[model samples]
Target: MGEVTGEVIVITSGKGGVGKTTTTANIGTGLAKLGKRVVLVDTDIGLRNLDVVLGLENRIVYNVVDVVEGTCKLKQALIKDKRAEGLCLLPAAQTRDKSAVTPEQMAEVAKELKAEFDYVIMDSPAGIEQGFKNAIAGADRGIIVTTPEMSAVRDADRIIGLLEANEMQDLKLVVNRIRSDMVERGDMMSAEDVVEVLGINLIGVVPDDEKIVIATNNGEPLAGDESLAGQAYINICHRILGEDVPYLDLRKKKGFLAKLFGKN
Candidate 1:
């Protein structure tokens, strides 16, 4: 048989507070739930939180630093997910700076990981700094996460440009925390607007929901839930697997005349 290879995707954002880590945790868990051996790597280095989001913080004995420093094997540093069978996490070191590991080292580690797992999701640090470079060191693809706001959309555009500069050609967008009510009122940017601005393939559109925070507070991803945002993540997982999944109805009804027709 031919040599097996898997996807190495870096999930990132240009600015902070765009729910990048949360999206990574959910998507990683969702992919594993679909029976794809998935590993979520926290490349946030000094500000590691993917472990906490996945509820694997208390179980970490070795980290990415250890793996890169040759103190431990990659298998030794991987902390498997509690809920998902095949999901695991290689958490970042909270004390080490971004300079602790070189891009070459990260790329080597990712190469080994992609050989064993079906997907390697890197939770990139916010900003276009060294941490960002390290996060995308070996990524074959990139997913930019942003909100339905002007600033977020702007930052996402910048991140997309950086990803292209890095030669990561397979780039996509995931618009999160979209408030349909506000979009309908013309107060929030719709998914179509963000896509038009960024000019990238739209992969996922996650709605704003309280369940996401609740799931994070409980140290779990909102993957198995039935909430709108949770279901959105599930659909995203399917799309990642090359499935032709259509987006759900996120728009609300206007007046009867507008509803019966197609426009207001």
Candidate 2:
């Protein structure tokens, strides 16, 4: 209508160790690669990894708490990415706990960021406590990341309910760390199955790629990868921007010889 405002989307998963930070870094990088001004906020106060994933760990002189506490200005706290022209990061304070800043503080920070960037992506801490509330305080949309495992899926379902209960309308799901081989073996749940159980729109599906681990170890993001999972994350970014980019095919490939041998 009157020039749509920027969207604040939180990349969250209720359960920990389900690739929530990975999704945030990749999506933020993908959005920036699309020539959109993007700012990634790490709201996982006690345990922060977004900075490491984005390779901005060494560059973080000030953090979100510094800005919120008036020790530094917002501009000072923002760590500009060297690779992505329009990408910046507001890392969390490792020394501070989740209660250091309130949800209102997080919302205020996101509001200021939305005025400057096309997208403000928040990396929320796991659980349904104050940290989780702070992460989504300023978000207009939510992207829940989960693996195919029962534990992650169960946590994701709870997260969706909490988001809805908090009056956050726009909700999307991203099933991460999916193994096509497992699905082919009838051992893993399909993307459609996860969506049906959660009852939300599927934004994308990321495979359990070894390249992602390598990238993370190298202080890089999978979004810059040419791998299958990388392509999927990139497509998810396009969808966030209202593009109709289709999802990538993550089906496991079978060897011709194996097929001829009737290998299952």
**Residue 264 of model 1, lDDT score:** 62
lDDT values for all models: 0.90, 0.90
Query: After superposing candidate 1, which stretches have Cα over 4 Å from the reference?
Result: 251-264
What shift in Å separates residue 112 of candidate 1 from its native position after superposition?
0.8
**Tens-digit lDDT track of model 2 for 60-155:** 899999999999999999999998778999999999999999999999999988888889999999898999999999999999999998999999
Q: How far in Å is the alpha carbon of 237 misplaced in model 2?
A: 0.5
Candidate 1 is scored at a TM of 0.93
The TM-score that candidate 2 achieves is 0.94
Per-prediction TM-score? 0.93, 0.94
Give Cα distance to truth, residue 137, candidate 2, Å: 0.5
lDDT of 1 by residue, 36-87 (tens): 9999999989999998889988999999999999999999999988789999
Q: Provide the clash count, candidate 2.
A: 0
lDDT of 2 at 85: 79
